[model samples]
Target: MNNTDHTTATVEPAIRLESVTKQYVGAETVTALADVDLPVYGGEFLAIVGPSGSGKSTMLNLLGLLDGPTEGVVRLGGRDVTDLSETELTDARREYIGFVFQDFHLLPTLTAVENVTLPTAFTDGQYADRAVDLLGRVGLGDRLDHTPDELSGGQKQRVAIARALINRPEILLADEPTGNLDRETGVTILEEVRRICERGVAVVAVTHDELVTEYADRTVRLVDGRLGEGDDGFAT
Candidate 1:
């Protein structure tokens, strides 16, 4: 069995945000995220639930190292990376993090397999072989040659999910991953995410879908850029 197939209790958190806050400065300085503390562990599916303008995107950006916090520390594999340079942060993102966005960002011109292998372009095709395996794992074995335009909504999302795992990242950050799918399709995609979490990849999903929260190992609500109440029990 692969190392990612089982969750190990001894593993440290994949990412941790301690008293993290994000502020945008312009005509008026605005705080996007307040002092938020979140720790994401391997094999965990954590849903960050909130309405629009409630800081979900801000938190996802901070967790994915796409943006630095105004204050506090962001740690990846327990190492403080809050002050890393842009180049260092870029390298860290490529090595340690995977991302899936709301829109199936598959290249319209690329085949499913090609889209899955896109991440390899940055690493000299080191993980190119895994593309086929990932596509099969996501139940798209027969759609390998299909382009995004030829696939169903769920199938296209499956391609995106497989692409996210091509790097074998320690953490997967999904922002409104199911926003474009129907209810049934969304459920199918969320189930795939649950399976990935079971395989020991920490999954942090920013979403407004209550149904998505039901699949999470734990759910934390955000309101007015701060952590709110409504602690759903962790997955057993």
Candidate 2:
């Protein structure tokens, strides 16, 4: 390898919110998030914690590209994607990001491997072997043929974790990832997620569950639409 290769390459955040804000202009104006600047790097696990109605969901939506910021920009791999069209945004989402929802939204009719490959539906490739491998990564190799109802809550979540990794996303957005499970199961799931982070995927999780902080490399909190790094917006 050329020595210049290491010297010339630049590292950028996997996804970031640069001076972002979101407001709901209804009968009343509601500022969901205000001027927040956050950068999540690969191989890092970041936990965003706050009470309900404190803009956690709003942040997740922005990070996941499900919605855009009313101000500032959302950047992916250092590229500004703040103003992408719906089609472009959809493609961006599919190519760059993965999500783990608390509900484990697996299709009841699909087996674990089938559900793991769902995100690749519009692509022209089949990923059966990769899906099987991801299931094995999450300790669900034996459950590949099981449907959502056939698996326990934790097993379903393990499947969800595997599904999120199938696309090899640079960033993984987990919304309340452990909210639906008991303590022991939740710990197992968190371990799987941390392992994913260690493999160089950026993991951003929004949660009210304090247990997430134990696995996170860093923690931040949102309060009244503002972001900070302390107990309630000071630590960042």
For candidate 2, what is the lDDT? 0.89
Query: Lowest summed-lDDT stretch of 10 residues in model 2?
Result: 1-10
lDDT of 1 by residue, 75-119 (tens): 998789999999999889988899999997999999999999897
lDDT of each: 0.88, 0.89
lDDT of 2 at 79: 81
Candidate 2 lDDT over 70-162, as tens digits, reads 899999888899999999999898888999999999999999999999988766556888999999988888999999999999999999988
TM-score of 1: 0.91
Looking at candidate 1, the ten consecutive residues that score lowest on lDDT are 1-10
Per-prediction TM-score to the true structure, in the order listed: 0.91, 0.93
RMSD in Å for all candidates: 4.3, 3.0
- C-alpha RMSD (angstroms) for model 1: 4.3
